[model samples]
Target: MRFVPLSSRLLPGYGTLVLAITLVGIGVSITRPYLSLFGTDVVHMSAAELGLFMCVNGIGGILASTWLGRLSDLRVAKKYIMLVAAACSALGYGSFLVIHSYLPLLIVSTVLLGLGASAFPQLFAYARETASRVPDVDATFATSSLRSFFSLAWVIGPLLGSYLLQAYHFSGLFAATAFLFVAVLAIVFWRIERRPPAGILGSQPVKSFAVLQNRHVVTACVSYVAVYTASSMNGLYMPLFVTKALHGSDRMVGSVVALSAGLEIPIILGLGALSARLGKRPLLLFGSLCGALYYVGAWFAQRPWEMLALQLFCATFIAISVSIGMSYMQDFLPDAPGSATALYSNTNNLGQMLGSLLGGAIAQWAGYREVYLVCAVLAATSWLFLLRGKRFKAQEQKALRAALTSQDIETTQTRRAANGD
Candidate 1:
């Protein structure tokens, strides 16, 4: 037998895949902080309108991800799909430079780049295919590690955006993000090698809406949505919580948010190893519980230092919960990893959109403190879903084993009967 080298045993185009995802992450992060700022300052849109824009964008992503994920599984050209997505994002974001009206920007933000955000689903599908081709690779871990790279981008993108906004205003940030997307498209086109079609990744054709029928998957998706919502709403309101409630400054909010991001690094690095040893369910449940506790603590925080400490605690739990949830989703839908991932991704986006809207509304009606309490309730409620998830997983494993055992017994009986025993 001819021996294959270790490098050859690795996934094809893995390097390019990582680079593409990292650039996408950076591109999004580069403009994230300025989205709200742009709506308020440049477009002169109200908070409700901004929230609706986010919701529509999220809904667009939800539609695109499921359809595109199915397309990728059907062996469509992944590089071409990525190129289209990146190109659309670039054009949409670039157009913002010339269009000053709220309606045009809203349409661009919600329909155009929002649809392009579907690229992540296809990107994940591509990663799954590449990882599947390689020997001795854990696709779950590879995917998790790929996602952690986004956090690294998160660390730098927002800080850069904030600085650029200080210097050149909202147009500068939008233009910069457009340039980043163009760079992403260029790098992916240059690096990825196209492959011939393999059969559809799944055993049968899957309808886009059919995925929602899986109860455990639905529970997991909803739990994830809740977790992400808490994170997004907190990010939006934390500045106010620190400044008005705790008597702090922009510098103080920056320090706390930075600390939160810093704390996630170690958690992300260690999560896979921990999951291997401790198993996915325990980690998921523990992380969810911890998230609930963190929000509860945040509600009680009275000083800037206390808020900072609470946020650090929250980041660790969020990292663990998200990593575990993602791994769990892949495990449950092993045959359709892309679709599973897309569902989780959509749930996360939906959560963030709803959280921002709801949190803003609560803050406006009652106060920041009430908003914190609501997030606490939401996080805690997520744990209930996890409890049911544990039972569902157990039943599934048992049924699978029982079916296998029955098949084995039937095969043995048939052999003996054929031998005239």
Candidate 2:
């Protein structure tokens, strides 16, 4: 049960890589809440438009993530890709200052922010490659821990966004995000190392469409999409549900959101350790089941406190599902960890987009209760998928072991024949 620390003897470039990731987290957090707020307050858009804009963002992420992941594997310059992405994001955020219309905002923001999504996959690939070069480090665990820092940013980012909105409005928030991206660009240019030679850093071109052929990879991606949808459905609509259905005040809703975000940290840290010990499949199934149960719990709650309590449970379940599912995906595709991580990450973005749009529509037509009920169903469905995924992963592992064993026996026979033993 000993936890492995990332090796201290990392290449100088790794430090810049971490810094780049931190800045990206900060940049995104700065603008996260403002996107919806801008659509509502500034552009006077409806809930549906807000949902669509968010979906647009996800579409951008999906396109960028897949391409950037492949590019990272091809030993492209991480710093160069990240710097351009950060600059594009900064431009996108800056454009919001003058963009009062929906269409322009959508196109500009997606192009800018969507490209920004490229940063994380590139950084993840860099981290995995760097860790592999170090003799003592476990790259998978290091990547997991490194990714956890984004959740930590989520805890702080929303609070900062809330305060910034209160003080300076949407423009201020976007401007702040722009500044963060500029800082990211500066740091990457100044500090990041040049791309290492291919194979030296475990960087190699991914065979075309090979990741899609892997059953475990596909299962993990699908499971993640479902789990993310379930989680984001609650996040996107729970505040409105609390305010409208339960007669909760804005203060109360904010408290619920804050509590959920704050609670995720411990849940993530604990679940990370638990996933390693108990294995990923059990945690994935259990987490999804608990998530479904939490939504059902929310449906029956009449009081504000009851809803708040359910939010905490929902957050806990999501933390378990995401942390474990991501680790599971990485373990399955250890050879191309970047693709695995990118696929998992993109599923999250897609899930959020779909969940937000669907949740908003359900809340609009069927009522908030129906939204929770639908979420519960989605979560429960994920359990079935995870069960199937578990079986597939076990079979894949067994087959791999058998292959390795045969290879070893063949090597032994060849050695014996050569020595006439």
Candidate 3:
């Protein structure tokens, strides 16, 4: 058997995507460590208000992802859409300079930042779009590598965020985030603004709701909702849980996040490369199952170190669910890659929203430790959904092949008619 090397499959502009994703990851993380504190201290938001704030943020992200995701599928170039998203994000983060009170922060954070953050799906769309232009390059593998760059960013961002927050405070943090976005925007604009959009086959605007009718898309979206809900629970309350439940310090919280990302980075890259051979569905299912196990492990963790140790499992789960999951989603919608990516992102945002809203309410009544168990259940549910939908995969593939064959036949007939043959 002839062995195919991974590097041989890489498409053009892979390096550029790596840089862009890294910057985005860092920019987003620079503010993450201080976001809740900034809301509470700078704006004096109550707990309920803060939760509502997060929900609004998540909703804004979902709306942006949905609208812009569909927009990417239109005649417009994905890079330009990316530029607009970056500009909006810059504007959104820039609001921090003028924001002093609650209402203003709420408005800017939800509408502006939310819209700005929509660039994430656009970035994925752009990279995938670029790869699609080149023959023989596996777009999934290329995008997976790009996605791992995000994990790399998280590893660097949070630690840097912690230091900047302590030294220069909110001003430094916001300024850094703004700078990162501006830099990325400038790079993307310079590189792609004048370039023509990737000529994707059958690339046309798709009715957003039409995708939901497909069982594979619907089931995948629901599975992601559960997966992301579990993630949101970890993102929102794990730090509090560490402090209150495990008697760990704030620094420990940062370390916990770092450990997961550190472990996840290699896993994401490795699995992404292997995905070509291993296949997306198996990776997704295995990851979902591991995710459930990780949450269960987290629920049982008694010490901060135990939480750190549990991250090994968390990394495996993330490796599949994050980048690999999105790639798997694209397999079901080869003709509408942008819409497919948008659906994946929308599910993620929805998950974050539901997780934050419910995680808080649950924690108040059931205690923080119990929340992990709930997350474990959600993860398991996601796995079941994925497993049940496995049977439909073959059907979806057959339909896609038939559609492509019909298109090819029609094109050949047109050429023959033009030739008067």
Give the better candidate number (2 or 3) by lDDT. Answer: 3
- As for candidate 1, its clashing pairs are none
Looking at model 3, residue 85 earns an lDDT score of: 79
What digit string (tens of lDDT, one per residue) describes model 3 on residues 135-212? Answer: 877677677778888988888888888788788888888888888999889878876534443234353334556656
Predicted candidate 1 versus true structure: per-residue lDDT over 1-421, tens digit per residue: 2443445434667777777877787778767645665666777766566666666677777777766666655566667777888988898888778887977777776667765786666677667767767777766566667667766677767777766777877778788889888988898788876654333433432333454566766777777888878877787777667777788875576566666666776787677667776777677778777787788888888888987777666777777766667767656545455666677777777887788788767766787778778888888777787778654455784554354445545766899999998
TM-score of predicted model 1?
0.84
What RMSD, rounded to one decimal, does every model reach? 7.4, 6.8, 5.0
Q: How many Å off is the CA of 412 in candidate 2?
A: 32
Q: List clashing residue pairs in candidate 3.
A: none
TM-score of 2: 0.83
lDDT of each: 0.71, 0.71, 0.78
Model 2: residues >4 Å from true position, as ranges?
A: 1-19, 197-208, 247-254, 391-421
lDDT of 1 at 314: 79
Q: Which has the higher TM-score value, candidate number 2 or candidate number 3?
A: 3
Candidate with top TM-score is: 3
